[model samples]
Target chain A: DQQVKQNSPSLSVQEGRISILNCDYTNSMFDYFLWYKKYPAEGPTFLISISSIKDKNEDGRFTVFLNKSAKHLSLHIVPSQPGDSAVYFCAASKGSNYQLIWGAGTKLIIKP
Target chain B: EPEVTQTPSHQVTQMGQEVILRCVPISNHLYFYWYRQILGQKVEFLVSFYNNEISEKSEIFDDQFSVERPDGSNFTLKIRSTKLEDSAMYFCASSEDRGQGHQPQHFGDGTRLSIL
Candidate 1:
């Protein structure tokens, strides 16, 4: 029973274009959502997140949109850079204590 | 920015041997968790701890596995008798609290354990 899922295994986009990654959840009790970017041989680094109350959250070039009714969320990176190429994992936490349901991760490749 | 830290970036242990993985979560964070990922697999939650007690744990956390916050700053995961299937990258993450959008968890570099 995977509560969180990223259906796309990988995505490719040109530099300076937009890269959108999607995620869905089955557990309605999840109140908070998070994104993490990981590179080879390193731990996942925290990215942006949004609460179920909000529709969107943005930080610099990255943005996250959450639709509670749809039980879905997506991450958008504008003007995608080569540096953004990595495995992006979408995570959701129910109440607290940092327990997260993680997706397998979507690998993004930026074409120059 | 305070971040989680793990020691002995890599460990190779023989089957049936006891192994302890250490971690130091962010100072102000109130929650700590341990997760593991097999090569090319999704990260799986193991256990979460708060107030010196386990808040939640997955089926993966069997009787052979135990967690302890021995002192002020250290969180450890111990495998009493590790098996070959125990080989994986163990990650430690910390969050300030739950339900807050800023509750972004910071993760350690992870301890990669190889069981032989």
Candidate 2:
């Protein structure tokens, strides 16, 4: 199922620059959207999430913007550091449902 | 901080052999889940358990697959017969509550299962 899609396979950013990763979903029932960061050989770590009722949520250098009408969301990492280099996955879930529709991750690389 | 724990970081077994992956969810968490990620593939949800019963399951969770909370703290997933396609990293996760606003699930490092 291609419900969620991250069109960018990879992204490169200079240290201290901004990295914006985009994701789109086809399912309107998805009320919760989350971003996860994963490193090699490890499980995904939750980064941030945005509910459909809200348009934006931010935590430190990371910010998630949700456009429910457009069925799109984006994760912005400001002052990107080398530690931020990893695969970022976008996931969406319907209310009260445990299943999360995941998108093909976008690999982010930070250059010094 | 409390975190989910999973045993057998890596396992290699012959095809058709049964394999059981174990997990211990967070102490105060009430919802348990099992998800898998094949190499180069997106994470896929297998099943979710709440109150000792399966609340929801995905198409991938078939008769060959079963989940149980044998004890108070442990949640386990069993594959009756393994196939080559079953080789993947199985992850266990838990949440404080389900469908109660924005409760994000915390995940374990995962157990990598390999079918030979």
Q: Given candidate 1, what's the lDDT at residue B38?
A: 88
> How well is each residue in B1-116 modelled by candidate 1, as lDDT tens digits?
78899988999999999999999999988789999998878899999999999989999999999999999999999998999999999999888875443577789999999999
TM-score, B chain alone, candidates in order: 0.95, 0.97
Candidate 1 stretches with Cα past 4 Å from truth are B99-102
Interface RMSD of each: 1.8, 1.5
Instruction: List the per-model TM-score of the A chain.
Output: 0.97, 0.97
Q: Pick the candidate with the highest TM-score.
A: 2
Which pairs in model 2 have colliding backbones?
Answer: none
DockQ of 1: 0.65
Question: Lowest-scoring 10 consecutive residues by lDDT in candidate 1 chain B?
Answer: B96-105
- Best-performing candidate as measured by DockQ: 2
Give stretches of model 2 more than 4 Å off. none
Q: How many backbone clashes does candidate 1 have?
A: 0
| Candidate 2 structure lDDT | 0.92
Task: List, in order, the clash count of every candidate structure.
Answer: 0, 0
